[model samples]
Target chain A: MPGSFVPAVVSRRRYQILGIIALAALVGAELLGLSASPPDRDMGHLQKIMYVHVPAAWSAFLAFFVVFIGSVLYLWKREERYDLLAAAAAEVALVLTALTLALGSIWGRPTWGVWWTWDPRLTTTAILLVMTVGYLALRSFVDEPDRRARWSAAVGILASLNVLVVYKSVQWWRTLHQVQSSPSTVDPAYALGLRLNALAFLLVLVYFILLRYRAARLERLVEAQAEARELAQGEELHV
Target chain B: MTPGSRRRLVLAGGAIVVLCGFGFLLYGGIGENLVYFLTPSELLARGERAYDTPVRLGGQVLPGSVRWDAEALDLRFRLTDGTQTLVVRSTGAPPQMFREGIGVVVEGRYREGGVFESTNLMVKHSNEYRPPAPGERPQDLYRTLLGEERS
Candidate 1:
């Protein structure tokens, strides 16, 4: 068994507690959603989808950040641990991206009167999703662990850079999408509830990534242990 | 390919996908996330009451209906597909070219009363509306063109 097993146990327990807390927080947010007023004379019920859609996109951004950090660490230190963390975060990011797209489409169908648009936000999100899935595919097909780690790290880093560009492209290009909602752009009327919902969603996202990372770590440990046993049996047969 | 060379290809491919994908999306939604547009003619032919959903109606600014209540800072105009006319109300200054017969997009909710309470107004301009080649298209091309077409 790997000596790294000790830290894995503590992390697993921590993640489980976080997972429970996140679940409770999400349920609480849903209750808040119930009491929330429908859209004003302008926006309508489609505004409510912001509570769900914004958070999913934010979480996807957070996950990509994780992937970026992990990728950088792996490249710098040549450590496999960083690579595993990057992979785990990428998986979570992929899920969040999918959720964001789905929720956004649902919202768009009503507000924009179309199920999909080539809006800056939606388009950037689609690209992010495709790149993430492609990264995972590359990892699975490559058998050499070290080579996989390096290649995936490079891809992750490039994709992370793309995220920033995609974000800025709206402002740089004369696109139809509105400029990003900054702190200044956030109307005081909607800010408080939106902040609270955003906080709740961020907590849930953090909890989910941590939990998934723990599971991934456990799987890695099990595989290493099995490989060690196989090596021992081969040595014995040789003797 | 050498393993190192293969890694380079992966990076290049990733960059291409990101760049091209974003370009396509931006190109598609430019001016507005105008995925689909219904002209005034289409709206009338399909029946106004057919879909209760809110969508963008693209058409020429009807010549006479524009009236600005300057004291109240309320701008009201009529948009027509040349078939059915709909009244539009906005509280901001209309675009410079937003005079009669120019293309504009008004985003708002559709009311049962045949009114679209516009919250946002976008002036849709053609690419030719850019800085004129020295003496190519005059500053007031629309006026000149209308005059020529009439005479």
Candidate 2:
């Protein structure tokens, strides 16, 4: 009775509303990025790519951080919900990371004069992308729920730690990639657009993670129901 | 101690051990693989040890020292770090952004012939947003027919 108190569909509706709001804000952020931000003196219009690139990268980092926390919690508590949450966050993080890399490549062609390079930051980020893909692939291979949860959680934790290396790669080694930009380093005229876009991306990240988590939970629920029905039918045949 | 507390202690101990192992590996990997960008003076400071090993040489392209053979895809330039200079030779067309007095990073091994043999060249832009100074524009290098009419 308590489990049936609140229906799942109601929660999904809330996520839908949030998703709409996020989409609208993202559009607004794009408009601001195009019109409000001043062009870089050297790079000129090519610098506008940063509005999407930096925010997507930041959101990817944030999503992976969530995966790190979820994995740690699942490992400690042995909770299925934490595992589900971790899987959902990992999925979102992978998508955002791929987007970040694509946008980066497009920006690099005009700015760095190369479509891709083996610079330290680029190399480390590429490694991160590969590791995350491996993490998701590993999750799919394990059929047993508990085993999948434990193994994927461990991998997720390890992959999350690699994110730190990616962040510090520019500083630790010689790289063609520019150093991290901050409010102090970035021109104030461009800062407002960047910050606005970053906020819009954060909203989108939260909405996506929430929807993905709910879908994962629904999938597990259906699986459990199917297993219960199979067991009941076997008992009926015996009777 | 209660079994729950004991289990927690074991879990925490395992986590610490795994994290420490990972940290050690990461540290060693970074230490071994970190390629430093050095000026010619810094590279020469290492003496004979710097020869034959790959390095990223970072400095400004010295003015009036660039030679480009577009047909042969040959590029030769002198890179200077204010105090010292090194001659660099490469087998590719220079990047569109490459210009005299601009910063560049050339990646390659130093050969015995006193020339830095570069396999890859990257233009390095400054973090600050500054317009090109007067007479520093690449457009000025061209003898425009439009400019002749004005003259």
Q: Choose the strongest candidate by TM-score.
A: 2
Instruction: Show where candidate 1 strays beyond 4 Å.
Output: A4-6, A11-13, B1-151
lDDT of 2 by residue, B37-78 (tens): 888999989889989998889889998988876666788989
The candidate maximizing lDDT is 2
Off by over 4 Å in 2: A1-8, A11-13, B1-27, B34-39, B42-55, B62-76, B81-83, B90-93, B99-101, B108-113, B117-119, B129-151
Could you give candidate 2's per-residue lDDT for residues A1-239 as a string of tens digits? Answer: 12431235556678889999999999999998899765465566666888899999999999999999999999999888899899999999999999999999988776666788777788778777877877787676555688779988988998898899989887777677777876676777778888899999999999999889888887777877888899889999999
Sorted into a CAPRI-style docking class, model 2 comes out as incorrect
Q: Which ten residues in a row have the lowest lDDT in candidate 1 chain A?
A: A37-46
lDDT of 1 by residue, A32-60 (tens): 76465333222334355667877787878
Query: Worst lDDT window (10 residues) for model 2 chain B?
Result: B141-150
- Contacts from the true interface found in each model, as a fraction, amount to 0.01, 0.18
What C-alpha lDDT, on a 0 to 100 scale, does residue A127 get in candidate 2? 71
